[model samples]
Target: MITFFRSFFNSKIGVALSLIFVALIAVAFAASDVTGGASFGGVGSESVAQIGGEDIGTGEFSTTASNAFDQIRRQNPQLDMAAFDAQGGIDDVLEQMIGSYATATFAESIGLGASKRLVDSEIAGIQAFKGADGRFDETLFRNALAQQGLTEARVREDIRRGLLTDQLIIPATFGAKLSQQLALPYASLILEGREGQIAFVPSAAFAPKGNPTDAQLQKFFADNGARYRIPERRVLRFATFVTDRFRDQVKVSDAEIAALYKKRSAEFAATEKRDVEQLIVPTEAAAKAIAAKINGGASMAAAAKEAGLEPVDLGLQSRQDLAKSASVAVANAVFATAAGKVATPARSPLGWHVVRVDSVSSIAGRSLDQVRNVLENEIAQEKLRQTVSDFTADLEDRIADGASLADIAKDEKLELQVSPELLANGQAPGKPDFAPIGAYQAMLPIAFGLEEDSGPQLVEVQQGKEFAVFEVQEIKRAAPPPLASIRERVATDWALAQGLASARKLADGIAKSSRTPAALEKAVSGASVPLPGIEQIRTSRQTIMQQQGRVPPPVALLFSMAEGTTKVLEGPNRTGWFVVHLTKINRGDASKVPELMVATRQQLGQVTADEYGQQLMAAMKAEVKVQRNAAALQRVKDQLTGRNREN
Candidate 1:
């Protein structure tokens, strides 16, 4: 079983699972904590990491770490960082903190600075910062940043770095070549078709006659004993401490609500709306021609029809909702036009527009009835915060008063859970789920730290909108399942081992005797190889490069062999070795040729981009002549918050 687990760890699914876990456990938590209200550990005050001469600050590192942390936490809630580092937990965060700073500085030195306009545009595009109708709202933007523990300048910088990184990579990887290949398939496969046939002497088809003696079994067992052991796992009990539960405690009085309404009266006030219809003409000359016919007492609809224009109706729309390019001009003209009247001509980014105001409405602020819903939400959030605060305080008081964790949660209406027994190295249960890395990290120490009969310990947990308090109840230890449970599996393994040796012997005989598919097939009658489709086997070196484990080397060797070449490929038992013959040549049909061409071009582009970036960095490093003051960088990182780590 341990051997199975280790082999699994080296498989494709294992690598993918590891990466996915890393992303969830590492990225999300870093993002949250650094951007949240957590204090910076004075990390970025001085330069912790350097690329060339750029001195990144502590504040920047903290912000970057926070963003990265949050991203990681969200993705992998139960990451076993012990497997990565003995220090585990926050040390992973520290590495990301340093790396992010280095990456950011490197980007800046390479002339990949993000512009203010880019940041502003990104902010405007965020739906959370938009008004009810989707127009960017300054108040909403500020409020959202505040919630994330970010200042406007910090958020802007975060957006800037993100954009810069994106810009830097776009041309490097997915430029013209990638785009063309993705858009067309024939452009990818550069080889013409070829003819060939393949036959495999399958290991499964050659069943051995009898079981080996005890000596043979002992030898094999001794040889592969390490493969059968399992990786270590960990057991944990913890208390979570999140502040969202106290949100209800912050109340909004009627007076405060009224005051807030008065202060933001402009926001609440409705703008005059118009039911408008418009026709756009590509040029001022076109607009004039259309306007002329309408001005000469011709119906605007008739003029629009003659000009092959499509009139778009606003249908009770506000000026705030229009695109910036046309909003100002269109709003002015539409407002100025009398109802049932057409505007002469207006110019916008796309072209000139002729507008007709169908109907106008009174100012559109919220009615008394509609304002209640917003007020209720505001009040409820305040109350939720207060409730959470009260709960935390009460739980602390109870613990101080010698009350158990179960008691506190019971009083607070929280849940108590017992996680599946885990091993010291995180090998228990199935694969790790990284959706709650922070919570799991927090839980682990408590579980390990507690003594038997310690009673309940209070821990914080999150469930979407609701917060939770978990009380660890009981724990079970690790012990192997009974032999009876897996006896059939063991017997099957014994049979397969015997079968594999027989299959390999058969294949070796075929490899020495045959040079054609027919001869090979005749040598191993009733073989289970997928040789029928082998005639279509055309592959490239790069395609072979993309493959991993048991198949890659064989494919590469096969590609190297000339037509009519014969050889034997050895593999592990129960997975019989192959006796192969290059019976036909289909350089075009083979997977290696085209895959290699595409891969070569991509590698070339990467080399170019990397060289360009290095050259720029080298120049900048020389010109700046940076004076080292690591302390200053740390102070800066300490002050900063809400930055992306990947930058």
Candidate 2:
């Protein structure tokens, strides 16, 4: 059963079950508000879904969706509802809910259920509900449930369902095996090496004859206008309040610094550290004998060697470090021993230890003069943080009362900066010369999301350093510039496109004419244009796939072709093309590559198990009839999105 559990948990079905457990746990706590009094009006009376004659209520569906949303929000604290909706988060949540309901219905049909005792045991085992003593505390459990808005009954039911589902699925998908015959061919192919002749035909070698005419350049620009179009740009007016600006104004007196130092005197005190060595033996008698020999005119190393054990150095450790790594008793004994003196035998979990203190560093405290600069800087920063907080709060209140950013900036004697035409990526045309009022990267997303009528919003630029209140002054929608405006860019692109086409044509001709490596080499040697240097090298499949440097297109094509076949392969990034001829093919023996074979076998086994589990789920889904009320589901979705709040 333990082996079965291990194998099942390691499988894809195990991963799915783990995800389900997390989802169910999240739903258990978040469903209270959703199920309490919320209604979808006409849709509330309808079933959002039905599986195997069991109807899933609209309220339950809404609750599940709400739980999923809350779980996602907790996982990604920066994620807003708009971003979540754009990523199809709602649809994903609904699908998962539907799947869970279907699976639960199937479990019931198979007469799978969890006992009350089992459910209780599971609840008690959860660490969140446990006290400091590691025992389940009723008060802590109730508080945790209350915080998540979950009732005990609902949580217990979720646990019971999760247990039943696990019982039904885990045993069925456990211990899936892959035969050696199934894995051998794949392992062999991956290990195969090929030797080939590769010749490069760079795009620059086949430069387009003469410049492109105005009509051709214009046509090229028009054809790919969207590629050159700029995204929407915004100009913002903002007022920044930086903590560093107030740092100079803060005065830290000598008295204050002294008080601060005295208050945190312990931090300036150094811990007593010692260098100790030990000879650990299996018995206390051996430890005592070794310690006696070391104390009785014999060297510690010599005594350790005599006992047929090497001395272990516990270098320069403090009391806390010794307590953690060794036993507290050993630490106490070592700390109590004088320098150049051997300590008595100390019993530990490992065995018994004979310890000697080589040298001891006495505890030392720093003088006020030593830490004066650090204290002053800390005090100044603290004062600056407080001043900035107060200033920003006042500015926020004034803005809330309808004061414009410019008016506030003037009144406060703060610098009011206006951004140039800024793209969504925070870059202006030409070289990026503009810096944002605060943290530009953090502010850009929020700035673009703002509406024209939204007025000003306060944004934290740097956590403890700066903040800004900014308003969009103007917006420019994305549009393509005229060909005349970007004639140079268009001409450059046109030339590259024509050059790539010419290179491809030349490569194709070379491939078509030459049937053997010797013939291809002869054609390249006699070609009028300057071509890439030819390098004939033996490369492997793994090297081609995983090498950091660019593997020429012909190198990849070599493995796919029979020996003595010539092929033209396209170059990466339209740099040019490669004409490759496969000269030799080498097959690898799978038995020699044990490491790769083992990895391939494990991969194939996992893949096969995952496929088997997917097939099982599909079959089970087919056996159970499912009905979805699209209208009701959409209504629930609308409610979640805050589109309509019909009761």
Candidate 3:
């Protein structure tokens, strides 16, 4: 029969707040944090989560959850949806949806608005929307949205709600700063120390002797099959070609070169450029004061520093360009000034401006004959790129017309390459030493997502340059290997499992029966088989915190246990159990540690800001009622887990 027990872990952890609150909603997804509550009686049954009056439909909820899961999987390549759901991944997504709408609802009631112009700026500022040239590319933005399975309207709405939440939360929290006096207590807690001893009960020491019978082995394998689950893996077959493939075949004539030269004659014309130092101030008087200081032999940098402003160097630019960037009056004064001299003060919309002429250089105009070679090179490069683009388009047409990757490879006389079966992260499970080819790494995402019987797809390997025609050749679904295929491994695991079960009970009894470290060590030392030595440690929680996420579970548990108490903790992966004893508590004084006090002040200052934000958000949420449709929620979850999946 199956057995279970309750576990009460120390719930005191970090605040997990982030500057990106919208992202935090997706990450924390605390259902309990959603303030108000109502039902779906007025809203339709198709709603998965509801706000005061706004409803998040089943389609949107499922899409949001799946996208979030995809993001988690990117970090943890081996994680599957089942394990993700067990960790409350589904609940978190739903809660984020509810929290977003609730915050929006509350903000709207208070007359806060997220304008269309503001949303446009936010979208334009997103780094993902920018192209290789570092400007917003609409095609790139659309492709990114397509990859995430998100609609433009959905993204805009998400940003809109986020802006609304920020409006409600930021101002209230922006001015909060933790005082040193307020940080003292928490600083002391961070420095507190503990003295403890740890004793291990190795399962290997108590492992069952000899091999199990076939029936016994089968039962154990059946009971713990998930422990041996093989992650999904795929083999991708493809051929790649670079831009160089068609470079030698490209041609550019003298006529084309001459034409380009004529087209860019203005670009090759002579121009004078100047570099200048500029300092802007609120008033014309302030600018004049700085300029007068420079005229009196005081360095522009020094004069500006005294006035609490800095000069910015406008790098070499032509007179016309400077006029456009600054103002016509300022640029004319700058260009007319002698080198290494200050110009008269001028005014622009930003403020008043003082200018210095640092250096100037003039270039003589060039003839068509003088720049013929450069023009020829530029034209040839452009023609070569055009040739490659045309070639790729033709190949795409062939692929669209039912041409296989093999046929393409043969026609192009290219060498086709195949990857070893690999997981989404390009890791080969069976071959632990295997490393994926760099070229194949970029294609794995598309390869893994392809239909089993789909045709070959021509994908860009390196944007605008290298290309690949690939398809998924083989796929192995995540499942347990056959019992006979892993019998020896299962048998070994069974022996360790049997020992772990007994060791857990023994370790528990030892903890309950002994109160002192000496007595605990004595009990552990007298086990049926010889075990490793008991480890004694005396350290501070500060030290454990310093170790960050690397602190061993037993050491962590030792700190949480009450002083003078013995407790049992399990080792990783059921390897063994640990009998822990806390000998003493050493709480140190933090009042004298200036460095720690500073750290505490900084950390608490952030916490103070977050706390203010949280309070504001909580109030907002309380004002807005939230409700969920249980049936629709269940259907979404079912779809996620492959039970009665929707088409």
Q: Model 2, range 551-608, lDDT digits (tens) per residue?
A: 6556667888988778888776566888888888898778788898898889888777
What local lDDT does model 3 show for residue 412? 95
> Which lDDT values do the candidates have, in the order given?
0.53, 0.73, 0.75
On lDDT, the leading prediction is 3
- Alpha-carbon shift of residue 477 in model 3 (angstroms): 3.5
In every candidate, how many clashes are there?
103, 0, 0
> What is candidate 3's lDDT per residue for 216-290, written digit by digit as tens?
999998899889987777888988888887878877787888788788887889888888888989998888888
Instruction: Judging by lDDT, tell me the better candidate of 1 and 3.
Output: 3
Candidate 3: residue 249 Cα off by (Å): 4.8
Residue 392 lDDT, candidate 3, scale 0-100 = 86
lDDT by residue (tens digit), candidate 1, 1-647? 00000011233234433343334222121222333333345342355445455434444445544444334434453432222222232333443333333445556766777677766777687666779988999898777766666666655554554455455444443443333344233323344332333445555555455665556655655555443433333434333445655554566677767766777677678778778777888898988887778768878778888888767876876676544537687777777777777776888887898877778887868854468669767766767766766666776677767887666656655555545556433334544563435565445545544444565555555533433344445544222333344344444566666667776776777777777777766665644443222332555544554565445345545665777887777655456566656666544432345555566467655555555544443443445443445554434333332122213
Q: TM-score: which is higher, 1 or 3?
A: 3
- Candidate 2: C-alpha RMSD to true structure equals 8.6
Q: How accurate is candidate 1 locally (lDDT)?
A: 0.53
